[model samples]
Target: MSEQVFLLPDLGEGLTEAEIVEWRVAVGDTVTVDQSVVEVETAKAVVDVPCPYAGRVVALHGAAGEVRPVGQPLITVAPLDAASSPAGGEPAGHAVYREEERAGSGNVLIGYGTGHGGAGRRRRRPRLAGVDDSTRTAPLPAPTGAGATSAATDPPAVAPSSPGPAALSSPGPAAPARAGDGAALVISPIVRRLAREHGVDLATLAGTGPGGVIRRADVEAALGTAPAPDTARGLSAVPDPSPDNGTALPGAQPQDPTGGDVIVPLTGIRKAIADKLSRSRREIPEVTIWVDVDATGLLETRAAINAARPDQPVGLLALLARICLSGLRRFPQLNARVDTEGQRIVQSAGVHLGIAAQTDRGLVVPVLRDAQRLTTTELAAELAATTAAARAGTLAPARLTGGTFTLNNYGVFGVDGSTPIINHPEAALLGVGRIVDKPWVVDGQLAVRKVTQLSLTFDHRVCDGGVAGGFLRHVADCVEQPALLIATV
Candidate 1:
């Protein structure tokens, strides 16, 4: 028998290490090629690392909750069919899965070579051995409409065949699934982890998602900790302190035993944000410019367009994005990045605009590709879809990268203005504040009009205050008289 070791491949986005969240397989279990054997949490997102070899698992390198560096041993498997081996192979029973031999899932992590339609393509999940076929049932067909399975219903059992919870190698505290209950129809590893943490029975809860898939909300609700309404939009509140108990609530850190201060560990998405913001502050020399504009015309223009379409209404952010595109056309310098290593400016030809969004996973900026080419309606649709994916934590890593400039609508936080930090490597960021009724001098008379603050924070290395001021002024002009867009649109 040939024992092949599977090394932990790079999880991409320059991440050096990952915390092993859970192991889906255990020693002595049979696994297929491209099967997800381990789940790891990186700085940005949680990812599933698929095994490249097909064989019986012999050894696991790391325990759950431990951090493993890239290129280290993750698992060892003994090939089921070894008699067909070549005459000359690696030294006695210590073989590594060669690059040519791997047939990986097409969802390739960066730096890892991608595989074609070999064992990588989607296929039916293999059933576990020793599990009776009668107990193993096919997954239930998804309900066609919402609330199809009412609260009165016991929620039908549509379990598929899996290795069961005992097969999972989790040293961390996690509730195991009951024996003979059948595998829960769960797709997300995060949801499973949350359910285990709270000791909630996955077999009991009815899935509200498509195809009877269980979502995080159902688990949270089962735990009796109602998620915030903003959670749907991807914004969640951070915990501070409790008056009576002196202990923080869930998602909050506990106070130190010394009775001095609370110690919150910096990790995951929060740490990533901290590192990027610090680097941006240390390396780039950024300048901020602001202007309070009369948005009366912008609001009226939106109302008129929505009235005409009625069904497909344009959002204010989309109109603002349209204006930003026009201004970038006039001042293309803003649509660029500074290359410190090459000691030169790297100007891009097209605008890949990044919209700053606050998600449950912290601040994530989803990029809209070829922003300059898309119409206002198209831009609106892209913005909505990207934001929704961000909230759902389903956005791909590629969508989070390759941004030329960023547009931050911090008005959702009810703030009037903010001198925001520029997304690293990007040349500029535009901030839009809340629009409110304020006194304005219009047509030589005092009038109450909708006014909002627009701030531009830009890299001085790419453009001086003159260019930055010009871009901000053009945006303000468009806000005051949206008809100015007709010239370019």
Candidate 2:
């Protein structure tokens, strides 16, 4: 039979490689055009790699947890009619393979060209035994806390892979383990790592997931009550082992040094973040400056807005974002970036504001396109939606890049101030600290006022302190006197 090998396609955002989280199609299983045959986790997102040819899978290239580079063969499929010869008298394998390629639906992964709509399916084509069309194209499960009814579906297309049978339906309790087989039906690396940390034997517990698969929640359940923050940080109560003379003391922690400490490899999004941050620090000469502002006026304005329109209350962050936009307009230098290779400070004409958001996956900055043009109400809505998408691990790669300037509200973390590292390629970042009641002199009288600190970190090469200070002062002025926003608002 003619075998056609499919290479891993670029999943966008210039990602060069992906880890094989799970194989959707096993050897000998027939797959149709545009049907998802493998699930891969790129640096940016976990995506399903669709099969371009309608054929039976003859070979699988990589195992779960193995990273594969772009342009490498992912799977090899033999067209169903490979044995039949064409009327042109070409080799049967070659002729059949050519026909299969011609019949391909030309559908690719997300953000790439896909012939099918969001349906992720095409018209019915020939199939083989052990292939169920319904389960192969099921939508990924919703993010936790979405309030959507949890349906038994494939784990997720944008999360760390969770492997199982093709169907999401439960197969009842798993049968008793056979000899020499002790690993449970667990797919998540986090779950496995956590279980190992807690010394929980997977072979001994009954999983609560579909088909008795072990889940993160199930492992936590077996550890009795949920783990407290500190305990959750590590399996044991011992703190991080202190180093002595630049060396780790033997037997000072949970794992013995003789056995070697865990060496977690940096991959996927974590690696990408590391590379960018390291480059920023190595290349950019940065300086930080901060100022404390009396935020009583901003608080009052926000409260009044909420009272006027409780249905669409504006968030404090949205107000601060508006202030940043105005500050950028006055001192555009802070909104520019140093194009080192190009040897120029490329100042963007419009503000592509980025909001630093923490998510289950990692820290991500989702950019709001043309943020300067949006009203406060529109800004609030976009902020809410972008932050939600970030937390849900569903923000598109495009939304996570191309930010000219960043607004970081570390206030949510209840911190007072931070000299945050600049997001790479961006010249500056504005950080807002928590607002709290503090004694302040107002109208020549001491009284409790809502006070917040604002810090700015900028690339020294992009602009001087005078420019940075002016931009920050403008923002602080807007915070202290909300009326200052009138001209720009």
Candidate 3:
């Protein structure tokens, strides 16, 4: 059998593993070259993985929710004319399968090649042994309409020869499949964890997702969290309270005297946040400095700008972001990354501002590319659109990364000040606290004014406190006297 195997391709941005989100094609189904066979979520974004070979699907390597590292067998497909190919067949390894992943983007992955053909080009993917073939059922042929399975119907499932849920590893250090724990058809690890925490039996609940895979809402519904998800307070709240960039999610507790212990395993974005933050703390010698500023001028300028363009009113974040760009222009040292291993400081040529936003998935810093070149209105529009995309989970992997500096507005959460950790490798992070009415000395008299606290966390390796303090003072001056930014124009 000229069976070919496709591996989970590299997700780039140095990500090593991706959790299988869904299996689009099953065993015995036919797939064309570049056809999306599975959906996988990396630390960066959720992406549909396309198969590189065209043929009959002989096997699927892992079930949804399983995290597979780069270069593992994803699917095995027989030759286009291999009509006699057997279903649920063992992967034929390098003798047949090549692990090239054509993930939509024609751009070839790091270690993977674009298989243009020829048997000599076949690359071998690591195969897992002792795969639970119980889930490997041959697809039942549809009875009518060109033998097609309609969209409303259940996706092709393996015949009774299998009660499914493919395993990631036989007994490796990988997370054990929930099926082994007597769970069924649950594709989301978060849902599984929620069920386990609430003592809810998965077997008794009906799933509402594609192919009967359990969803987070289904589990939440079982737990009576029904108050319209949009209004519910849990993971969806914005203005992340955690000390900037990467930190633990809010509402996490090590111990609860009344509830024994509620432990949420770090997964998905949470895991990414933890990894990035841990790296930042371990390698970077960081320092923090904060200043309280009279933001009345900045806010008044925003109001006047909005009054002129009522249809496109600017936000406080937008004003603060513009001021940040100005400050970075004056002190380019803060807009940089540390090449610790190379023992070098790398300042960015252009400002790719990372906006820290709290999304339903978690806190993601979506970068505004070439931010230094944008007008205040363009910057505001881009920031708003990028943040919306992040929350809506439509942002591409590239948009979520490659930030030179970060702007975190913890003020959205109504906090006064925070000592935020810098995003990993990045030299500095600028945070803004809430703008509130407070007593201020204006014209040498104590008067009520809009005040806000600005905090900056910078890598000591990048610049001394003198530079950091100067950059921060510049930002404060811009806030106190909005005309300072106009002077540059």
Candidate 4:
């Protein structure tokens, strides 16, 4: 028997690695082509890998919840001998069955390629149907046709039989003999994890996944109980007063007397984020500069613009991006990075601004390449696409690379200001804070005016405080007088 090795494919995003969320097969088990053998979760989405060979499983390289790099072998299969081919079966080494070929074949494996001659693709296996010979043991009842008798009134066509040891030990339902054979329960990894953590029985929870597979929300809903009080409180509510304070209850137990609490292992995007951030900090020499801008005029200008085009309104970040691009033109030094290894300064011809967006997978910076050439509307569109992709974890590797500078908008989170970190290889970064209405003396009389804070952090090696200040002042001017951007652009 020849063995075939299956390696993880590049999941369309050019990601170098993925986490093995779950495995549907084990060693010593027989599997057919196109069967879902494993489910892997990349930064942006979860995908199921189908087996490429039909044979008994020989080895598994990784366990569930383990992180594996791309191109690594995920599973191995040993092909059956050509002489042992079932009646009418294609000769051994003949191309494995494909879905298109299953149309004519009567015997088909569930979740695998169709039978001998174009059989319909195997149906997904139901969860409760025991793994071994489930199809044979619990085939779906025959449909009632005009001439057909109901299963209830007629003698059963099939009888229940003892499943082999391998089938009984399998994790999911056994493959069926034909399409529409039986209902298979599908569940997501997140839903499964939630169920396990909450001690909810998988059998009791109805799947909401594709074709009525169980989903995370469905599992949570079925549990009917909220996460532990501590978990919920930690996520949203403010901390309670210390016990030493007068507000302390007399008999309240102290929080987790143990110094250490639960520890969740880092994997997937979170792991990628930690690694990148550490590399940036260690390699880049950062220097931050703050400018308290008189944003009154800028705020008024933005309001007027929004009022004029209510449907296609521009955000403060859009205005900030224009300013940053304009400043880059004025202080070209800020647009250049030090190439120490090359022994030269590498200055980019155009500005590609990286917008730092926070997602469930931590921070991802998607680049708006050539920001200087884009109009406000175009910039907004790009921002929307990048952010949506970031949140979805589907950003291409190129989109996350090649940033000449970065802009972080903390204003949306209600933060007044922050000294943002420079993405390594980028010379500078700009932070925008929330706009507030404050008292200001305009033309001698005190009046309420809008104000905001701008923080710029740069590489001192390439840009001095004077240049940094000048770039910031230009940004302020463009924001304060919105039309200035037209001339600068």
Candidate 5:
């Protein structure tokens, strides 16, 4: 088999590098074309890197927790038919291997990713068995929650070289042991990441998901933070006692050399956030404007809608999103971004609304593509689904970028107000504060009402205070009277 080197393809969005999270196949292990061989954590998301060549793995280029640049050698494979040829040597069985490569993978990376579409068939292409038995498996089991699903659809692709043993020698009730045996029933890489951060052992903890799949909740429960209905027994309430294991956050520097402080290496999501925020601050001359709004009508409208369709109740954020959409329609200046290189203000034809969600990894803003086309209900559903994906750490890299406008609901953390840094390139951000009971004048009379503080941080380069105030006032008007949305519709 001719040895083919697989370089880490450019994981889009102009990303230049990624941190190696784990490797599914070790040296000597066989892999099929499109089979995920590694999981890499980029600035935006955790993604599975598929093998383009179907062959026996001869070399792994990097270890977990290391950063690899784009176009660098990731893995090396000896094509199944090229047994006599070694790397850098003339191919003995080159014709057979090259033919298979051309037919199977088209001589390169498969569209930069096979993550969401998923790899075709994980089953090995049989040679010893002397048959092509690799067939697509049955459907994935029912989803328990956002990150909780079967291994078929979104396999976590746990690495064989876990810090601890893969599984217990003695099995428990949830599923079979995995050490030196089979793969772990983990569907989300975030769950695997969470376990590593908290030093939770997947082999020991019984999963509560479909067919005993370990979900993020299982790891959280094991960490003594998130509650679980049927968490595994015989698990430690705290992180394990490994010297440099999950107990510490990922990317944390090993014990301080000078005993001064534990320095956390800013790499994955944290680095992305820092760079974006710094660029936004340095480039944009920004301004913050806030207003108090009576949200009684918005709350009532939501209640009436929920009463009408309890099965698909609209969320407050969705309603706010609807309001933002309307406000932007009236004052489209807020729905824009600044092009420094081009020296112009670019207004988007459609609103790609970004919703900020805080997960175990950090803050992530998942964008809704062409949100102008979605109704409030559709907006709610999209928000819910993307929020789940964000929480699961499975959000596509595409979903994390290209936002024309941002809606930050920091009220979930009970904050009254914040002048949030604008998502870089995006001209504006609308922050919604906690809804609380406050006294307000209704028809010149004092009354207690559901009131919320709204904060708008926008680029001075995009619009002046007049345009910013007009947008915020329009949103407040919609909050005070949901019927205003009719005109928008």
Candidate 6:
């Protein structure tokens, strides 16, 4: 049988090496063309590399967590037809192997390919059309009052009945009530932990989050202005309100603080993020520029649009995306990347905007392909899909890569401004801050207006300060006068 060697391909974004995360096929296992052979974690993302050859796996080069360079032999496959060669064809076999080696030399494994050369170009996928744009305006879950008694008093009909000793003691629906319905809150894990440590009841807090889902802000609001408990004065002791049913057993003793502590190993998404961010900081040189924008016009336009289409959930980010896309056309330099190997700048014809989403695992940037071509409603639908997939950890490898630019909204976190790190390989990244009422001079008169801060971080190697400033100004112009976006488009 003839043996064929499989080499690792460059996975693009200038990644030189990857750590093998898992091997789907073992020695003696059969693999087909385009079938995943192994999963590799790169500095940017986790991707499954498909076997280019169809044959039985003869050997694996290395185990998981071993970093291997690009274009190196990763595995060997013995083709089924190798035994049929004539005795005298040994010389011819060597020649064929050499030819195959040469052919695979320049081929990249996945998203990285020389088809576009040093340009780093990709074909834009068409946006999924005809989706309801109205859903973009869907209200986020609002904060609800914490505590069972508070919720029971507010919505008596929906509250669950107090289970008896037999029901409460059982490990079923009773667990939720015993936990004070805190589990029902849609807040993040960190928020939940904070609430528990501070003895805050999620049910008693009024939710300001979308869809009446209680958020961290709601919990803080509920605990507002309360005097700090003095632990030394014995004012810090709080009673546990868990139901005391006859069938329920006593709780376990608290562990010693000085005893052995838990050591949680970073794996999955967290590990992936650390590797990527470290690589980006080491490889890419980032420069940032901040601009203050008057968002009064944008706010008014959004309100009017929402009023006209009450069913759609239009968000501030969606509007900002539209403005950014419009600005990218005038300043296409911001829509490109610098190719250090070629010593030239490569411009992308299409706009794929990546939005940074914080999930339970880590930060994920899912691309909204062809953001420039999509309508406001279409963009909103795509953004929702990307974010939902990210939070669910179902985003495909392709969706996580090939971003022309990125947008990070720190406003949701209540931060007014921040200098965001640029997603490597992309020319620029935009950071949007919280909107607030601020005094501004409009037409020479001072007035209180809704305002926000926009910060742009770019690769100085490709774009100069002048170009970056121009791009920021362009985006600010569109956001301040959103009507101009429709007119220009």
Candidate models: Cα lDDT each: 0.67, 0.65, 0.65, 0.60, 0.68, 0.59
**Model 4 C-alpha lDDT per residue in residues 211-231, reported as the tens digit of each score:** 344555565575555333233
Give the C-alpha miss distance for residue 323 in model 2, angstroms: 0.6
In model 4, what lDDT does residue 121 have? 54
Per-residue lDDT for 1-489 in model 5, tens only?
Answer: 469999999787888998876566567555656666777778887776777676777888877767889999999998665554447343322222111111111122334534444323332221100011122122222222212212222223343331111221123322433432333455445566566544555655665654355666766766664333222221222332221111111233223233455345688888999999999999989999999999999989988998999888687888999999999999999899988899999999999999887766778888998998998899988888778667666666878899999998877666789998999999999998888999999999999999989999999999999999999999999999999889987
Greater-TM-score candidate between 2 and 4: 2
RMSD versus native structure for model 1: 11.2
Q: Who wins the TM-score comparison?
A: 5
lDDT of 6 by residue, 52-113 (tens): 66666678887665677988988899875556333642211211111101111122356422
| Cα lDDT tens digits for candidate 2, 210-273 | 4355566676676764333233223252122111001111211233224545443476677777
lDDT-wise, the better of 1 and 6 is 1
What would the per-residue lDDT of candidate 1 be over residues 203-282, giving only the tens digit for each residue? 66665654344567777776665333222222234432211111122342222334554333466666888999999999
lDDT of 6 at 231: 34
Ranking by lDDT: 5, 1, 3, 2, 4, 6
Backbone atom clashes (below 3 Å) for every candidate: 0, 0, 4, 16, 5, 33
Q: lDDT (0-100) at residue 488 of candidate 2?
A: 69
Better of 1 and 3 by lDDT: 1
Least well predicted 10-residue stretch by lDDT in candidate 1: 240-249
TM-score of each: 0.72, 0.69, 0.67, 0.64, 0.74, 0.52
Which stretches of candidate 1 lie above 4 Å from their native place? 81-107, 110-115, 118-162, 165-184, 190-204, 208-212, 215-263
TM-score (C-alpha) between model 1 and the true structure: 0.72
